[model samples]
Target: MGAGLPAPLGPGGEAVSTYLGMPNVRPQPAHAPAHPLRWGEPFPEAAHETLANGQMRRNLAHATRTIRDKRLRVTAELPDWEALRDAGAAIKHQVMSELPALLVELERNVTARGGHVHWARDAEEANRIVTDLVRAKGADEVVKVKSMATQEIGLNEHLEAEGITATETDLAELIVQLAGDMPSHVLVPAIHRNREEIREIFAGRMADAPAGLTGEPRELAMAARAHLRAKFLTAKVAISGANLAVAETGTVAVFESEGNGRMCLTLPETLVTVMGIEKLVPTFRDVEVFAQLLPRSSTGERMNPYTTLWTGVTPGDGPQEFHLVLLDNGRTKALADEVGRQALHCIRCSACMNVCPVYEHTGGHAYGSVYPGPIGAILTPQLLGTGTKGSLPHHDATASLPFASSLCGACYEACPVKIDIPTALVHLRGRMVEAEQRRPLPTGWATAMRSAAAVMTSGSRFAVAARAAGLGRVAARGERIGRLPGPLAGWTSVRDVPAPPRQSFRQWWSQHESEER
Candidate 1:
């Protein structure tokens, strides 16, 4: 099935290999039995523990850092990168503010081109729409292009319940699918595993996997190509996520390193695309900026290998039936936030995750959601709202995510859409501290701050407080304060609070002046 290309009839007297040019294969979706329970709980203790594995951490660190390095070098080549970023942000903000109207326009354009558009308010609706679309075609199987939105909505699992199967055709997605695991990275879904783990997964899991498959990179890719070829050629339906959808023409675009996305988009009789409403770009010209920004930021390449574009259905060619499922799924809620709302500008290049120290250490699963890294920290809290099953609302252990950065601001610099992540982190931190505080700040703390504010405002009070602080410091010696006796304990737990200086600068200056005289 993997070796021989399956020739399917297209136009008159023409046959082509639909699924990566292979025969007798079928794309089947990985089972997602536990996906429902995954909702509500932002952090699953089990997934948290899974991230502790040194092997996964090592693999992710190496891969992400390598990609980050390449991205930096390539991004430096352009002097106007910042200009492009601002434009991307501005365009996205415009879409977010006017999503409903833009979506309606998009529907009109798509429908004019013979495409059907479906609106999904949330994950369940999105899944139902896609599942029903496949069922309507009487298809038991469908092929998929790698998409974070589908993962968030658990589309594969949803289809399984309705007796439909969806198989992933991308190489990394195939590895994740065959291993019965969740994707831990955005651009590279299987980044946590090395070639050895991949070899084991294919050998152990694939029913028709060639015996004694070597761990060579080329060998593994060939194996996946063989496995997915059957699915691509035989499946009646294909599902995908679009990187950018042009509102002017209702044209959807997907950028990918591998040619698999192209194959998936074109091979099936029916095509269903689930895209976030925020993905809309005002015009085709806007693609110029993203086309340059995305590939470099994501894969560290100047240009992606395959950039696929389709406007509805083409005459007698490539997926006669086309459905666009515009997914909201809490995006509207994120949009409503004024300060935190800039998160929607994310291009999903994943440059933020690659440079993130927290992501390097904890890996993606610790966040316990589809979107991970800096973007996830802000996006997840807002999308799920404050009080999810967790006690802390946004203050779950993932709250630790905001603190994960050194406040280096590298993420903001590397961001393609110019999201101010440090600013967002600070904002989220305020929310977390407020959530953890329960009642208003205590009277004593409030009074202390007031006293400090007054002292700083008035020189006389300032001098008095400085003298008092100096006296306390002299009494305490030079030892670091591990715990504060009063309301300041939270500050001392994760940090060493330095004792006050022995003398105020004013006193020292006075003594020096007298000595000089």
Candidate 2:
């Protein structure tokens, strides 16, 4: 209220909240995201590290399989499941087609309803807007529901920099936050950690973890419940990400299995929802389609346990003050691509990730982005710009991501909204190749591909190359070539390549047929 003091969130501020009583220093950007989900290196390099972790592989395998079976069972119960998928995708398409007009309408409606709507072109602006709101509340601590948009913008770290603390309320997210680790899966962030590892993380890091904690699920839930209950009762502000934002009604919908999101939505005096602009659906009716599709696809539940819908502010029922930060962060640019635009239809159900062979083996960390699995491979590169090559924040991790998949089409089949992830993967790979073409010299992969193309384009050249392949006979032992020289060595690292037959199939056929002729 004083002249020199900060203005009320009339919107943006700075400082760090102490995490777990560690002297709150001024907030800094997220600890240089150098982990699997941070886009620190090429995916293969990181995947190699992850693949070497046998425990992580087993953890991912077990979790994905269990979730996959549950999803299949629930989804099969709907006789018109495909129809629901079609409806959801159609609504998303309409949203994209009318996004500009819809967004303007959303702003008007939200403003009319007494909520402040802020448009952010990128992450820094969104972070500033949120920090200012927290500052305006004169609140040092805030509780949060699991929100992908907030994570994408590094909200927690940004708040920390300004001396504000944000605590995650979702149980899995709480585990990840306590362990100081990056999320390894989409719906289940800590899926990479087994029960024992989670217990260790809780015992070692959680300030309020029970004195003697067991690796049992019930105990962990109780411990987190107690911790969040205290925070929920006292917190003045809450931050969340929306599962769907209805443009027609100016309402945001969140489908959560845990009741934490509900508490965050209702308990706080100030609620800030940071949502991706692409999350908008054309009408509230579309929710009917997605409400079913999303739960079955994401958590494998017939219906999510908690469904919360809020619009603007209410006098006494919920938060008296509300802020909505609609984030762009490169979504509009991605929408420009005809083939790639379908990637935006994702509702974060994470079905595609559950069925992906590469994701199953490598886990979410391998992709090196907040969004992991098949979706991350396509989405992260476009959001950060495929050019982020070095150690910088938002370094382009696209080059490694498109290649992360086996192109088996499982992700496409599993996608609830029919994103055609394989098509997007190929489109992005082509873009990567075209980008590489502008260089002075072709890359090794490009060179090999070109050579193969040269041989295959002409029948005579192909015949000559088929004969030349016989040179591999020298390296052959018994029925297969166990090792190869040059760049080809990587192919034989784990599996044997069959050596060219002593006589090519074409040669044997031509010899007998020529004599017959």
Candidate 3:
């Protein structure tokens, strides 16, 4: 463990570094939160560590800019892109309202077609179900198709304890797995690592890697391919997460850039899928809307390289045995809130992450969730929840996530489903303040905010404070103040603050009106 860093207990009950080997896993992140994403450590401290890495910042800047540009180009090619986005959001909204009925119908249809449906209210149940299914198939190892749900349940760690190995087949995920690291991006797990770093990881970890591996992109990809091909051919069971599960046909969709998902789904004899309860669409037509939105918004492609959909077992082709695990994990609680439930509409296009400034700087591990970026800031806290009166109580660091962003709404503009991320951030902040009221006396930021609120509530007091702020010119150099004293120094340490004007805006406007009169 790093010096002075606290060790969080790992899934196997062993003491591990706060960061573990993987970037996202915290030692023991609160009293056993069910989801893989919930870690109690505040995001700010972790962000500090990532900020110190010049290479990480460079990698993220290039990758995010590339993806963002491509997405714009492809999306502009379509006249109905906005319409498709709106339609996608509406379809998901409908799914949330009718989720129960849709789920039951999906289960019935899936079961009738020779599939088994398992309902898991939380992460533990989902892991147990998958582990037991692998055991039932008499398999010690399973190949994976890069499912977010499995990561949510921390299934790989659980399987390891049960003496099972889960091989990740996606190229980025392979890099992450071989490096014993957590995924840093939804679509690109090792987006933090450049080609040179990838070459190092492959050369060190992959025994079959070419003798003289180079840091070229194609060579790196070929190395990953060779390593994964062997796993696909011999693995008896495959596990996946669905992009969208259609209730009308009981079909699951898997969209990917590479064909690894195809190999994992077809080569294995037994296939098991762990899916979030909110991943369903009422009909395949609704899936059509997301298909258009997801590919363009996420990968900047009009069509994914592979769009695989399956309904249960397919006789002589594909996996003969199929299992569908419906996971709640805390989504139901998130749905109860009128304002916040819009988060459930996310299609995991990852457009939000691709355009996030904070994510661009800190990378995914800072959020300490399998689901990172802007969505993670809002979604992770909801999954574990603030200690609000009626909800599940956990005073973990996920609470700090609401303030992770610059309130830049680019995430919303990039979103295919139009999740109002800025609004959710503000809403969660309100909830955090309310939750603090019920706890011990406010401290630090909360106390500061309360004091500010009292000062600003009345016009006379606000004017007085505004006049006092003018005195800040004493510390100013030109129009900007480079540093500040006391707790305010934290803001100035990173970025300069503008010097307060000689007069407040309200005063200036009033004086102008009086002069005219």
Residues 223-278, candidate 1, lDDT per residue (tens digit)?
77677778878988999998999888889999876667778888889999999888
In candidate 3, what are the lDDT values of residues 255-306, reduced to their tens digit? 8766778888898999999999999999988877877887788777777767
TM-scores for every candidate against the unseen true structure: 0.79, 0.89, 0.84
TM-score of 1: 0.79
- The C-alpha lDDT values of all candidates are 0.73, 0.78, 0.79
Candidate 3: residue 279 lDDT (0-100): 93
Q: In TM-score terms, which candidate is top?
A: 2
lDDT of 2 by residue, 18-129 (tens): 0111211222222222143445567877887788767667676777787788889998998999998888888888988999999998888888888999999999999999
- Poorly placed runs, candidate 1 (over 4 Å): 1-51, 388-404, 433-517
lDDT of 1: 0.73
Candidate 3 matches the true fold with a TM-score of 0.84
Q: How well does candidate 2 match the true structure in TM-score terms?
A: 0.89
Better of 2 and 3 by TM-score: 2
Score residue 470 of candidate 3 by CA lDDT.
Answer: 90
